[model samples]
Target: MENVEQEFLSVIREYERVIYKVCYLYTTPNATLNDLYQEVVLNIWKAFPKFRRECKISTWIYRIALNTCISFIRKEKNIPEIVTLTQEADRSEEDDETQAMLQQLYRMINRLGQLEKSIILLYLEEKSYEDISEITGLTVTNVATKLNRIKDKLKKMNKED
Candidate 1:
C-alpha cells in the first residue's frame, strides 16, 4: 500500500503538467478547471491500488486523466456559452505563434459536441490511434474514422473563416 502511494505520488508529480493541460483543453467556460483537476487527483488516489504497472506510467496516467475528464464533461448538465482563450487571458507579443494557432483551433473544438471534443483533444495531443482507442474504449478504426471526420469539419470551418 505504501509502495502504491509512493508510485501514485511520483506519477502525479511527473505528469501534473499533462493533467493541467488536458483540463485546460477539454473544460468549458462553465466548467471549473481547478475543480476538475481535484477530481482527477482524487480519482487517481482511489484507483492507485489497482495499478499493476501493465503499461508505461505515462500511458496509465493518461488513461486515468482522460477518463476522468471525459466522464466529468459528459455528466455536467449545464452547458454555458463557449469561452474563447483570448477571453480567458490576454495574448502577449512574446507568446509563440503556435499558441495562437492552438487558440483558434480550440475555438473550433468548442463548437463540437462533448464526445467529439474529447476525441479531437486526445488526437491533437499526439496520442496514437491505438492509444486513443484504448483510453476511449473505441476501436482503432472508429478512432480513425472520427478523426477523419473531425479533420474534415475543421477544414470546412477554416474555409468559412
Candidate 2:
C-alpha cells in the first residue's frame, strides 16, 4: 500500500502540469479550477490500480483528466459562465499585445464542444494523430477529419472577428 501511494505521488508529480492545463482549459470561472484538478487527482488515484500497461502513462493521464473535466462540466451546467484571464497590468506594451492575443485564442477555444476541446488541446501539445486518436477514442481518419473541421471553424471564427 505504501509503495502504491508513493508511485501515485510520483506519477502525479510528473504529470501535474498536464493535468492542470487540461483543467484550466475545461473549467469556467464559475467552476473552481482547483476543484476540477482535485477531482482529476482523486480519479487518477482511484483508477491507478486498474491501469494496464497497454498505453503510455501520459495518455492514461490525459484520458482520466479529460473525462473528469467533462463530467464536472456536465454536473455544473447551472453555474454562471465566466472566463478569467491573467491580468498583468504592469506588463510592457508588447507583452500586453501578446496577452490580448492569448485571451482571444482562449475565448475561441472555450466556444468549442467538449470533444473538440480535447482534440485541440492534444493537437496544441503536438501529439500525433495516432496518439490523439488513442486518447480520444477516435479513429485516425476521424481525428484528421475533426482537426480539419476544427481548423476551418477557427478560421471562420477569426474572419468574423
Candidate 3:
C-alpha cells in the first residue's frame, strides 16, 4: 500500500504539468482550475491501479485529464463563469507577443465545441494524429478530417476578426 502510494505520488509529480495544462485550457477561473486539477489528480489515483501498460503514461494522463475537464465543463454549464486565456501576471516583452497570440488563439478555442476543443488542444500539444486518435477514441482518418476542418474554421474566424 505504501509502495503504491509512493508510486502514485511519483507519477503525479512527473505529470503534474501536463495535467495542469489540460485543466488550464479547459477552465478560466482560478478556483475552477484548482478544482478541476484536484479532480484530475483524484481520478488519476483512483484509476492508477487499473492502468495497463498498453499506452504511454502520458497518454493515459491526457485521456483522464481531458475527460475530467470535459465532464466538469458540461456539469458547470449553468454557472456562466468568465473565461480568460492567460493567467500569468508578469511577463517579459518577448513573451508578450507570443502570449498575445496564444491568448487570441485560446479565445478562438474557447468558442469551439467540446470535441473540437479537445482535438485542437491535442494538436497544439504536438500530439501525432495516431496519439490524438488513441487519446480521443477517434480514428486516424477522422482525426485528420477534424483537424483540417478545425483549421479552416479558425482561419475563417481569424479573417473575420
Candidate 4:
C-alpha cells in the first residue's frame, strides 16, 4: 500500500500540470475549475491502485482525466466554456499571445453543440487523428472530416467578426 501510494505521488508530481489543464479545459469559472481539478485528482487517487503500465503513463493519465472531466461536464444542466493549452517548453510573448487566442477560441467553442465542443477540445489538444479516434471512439476518418468541418466553421465565424 505504501509503495503504491509513493508511486502514485511520483506519477502525479510528474503529470499534475496535465491533470490541471484538462480540468480547466472542461470547466469555466475559477471555482468550477478548482472543483473539477480536485475531483480529477481524487479520481486519479482512487484509480491509482489498479494502475497497470500498459501504455504510456501520460496517456493513461489523460484518458482518465478527460473521461472524468467529460462526465462532470455532462451532469451540469448549463455547461460553461473551457479553455486549455498545451504548455510549450518555451514560454515567451508569442506563447502568451497564443494563449490569449486559446481563450478566445474557447468562447467560440462554447457556442458549438456538446459533441462538437468535445471534438474541438480534443483537436485543440493537438492529438493525432488516431489518438483522437482512440480517445473518442470515433473512426479516424470521421475525426478528420469532423475536424475539417469545424475548422471551416470557426474560420467563418472569425471572418464574420
Structure candidate 3, residue pairs in collision: none
lDDT of 1: 0.77
- Backbone clashes in each candidate structure, one number apiece? 0, 0, 0, 0
- Please give, for residues 27-84, the per-residue lDDT of candidate 2 as tens digits: 7765677999999999999999999989999999999999999999898887636355
User: For model 1, what is the alpha-carbon lDDT of residue 22?
Assistant: 67
Of 1 and 4, the candidate ahead on lDDT is 1
Model 4: residues >4 Å from true position, as ranges?
29-31, 79-92, 95-100
TM-score of 3: 0.90
> Candidate 2 regions off by >4 Å?
80-82, 87-94
Pick by TM-score: 2 or 4, better one: 2
Per-residue alpha-carbon lDDT of candidate 1 for residues 40-159, written as tens digits (9 for 90 to 100): 889888887877877766667777777787788777757744646644334554367867786778888878776687788778778898888877788999999999999999899878
Q: Judge candidate 2 against the unseen true structure and give its global Cα lDDT, from 0 to 1.
A: 0.87
Every candidate's lDDT: 0.77, 0.87, 0.86, 0.73
RMSD of each: 2.9, 2.9, 2.2, 3.6
Positional deviation of 142 in candidate 4, in angstroms? 1.7
Candidate 3 lDDT over residue span 1-161, tens digit each: 99999999999999887888788777845347789999999999999999997999989999999999988888777654535765532345548788887778877887888899899988988999999999999999999999999999999988887
lDDT of 2 at 12: 100
Q: Judging by TM-score, tell me the better candidate of 1 and 2.
A: 2
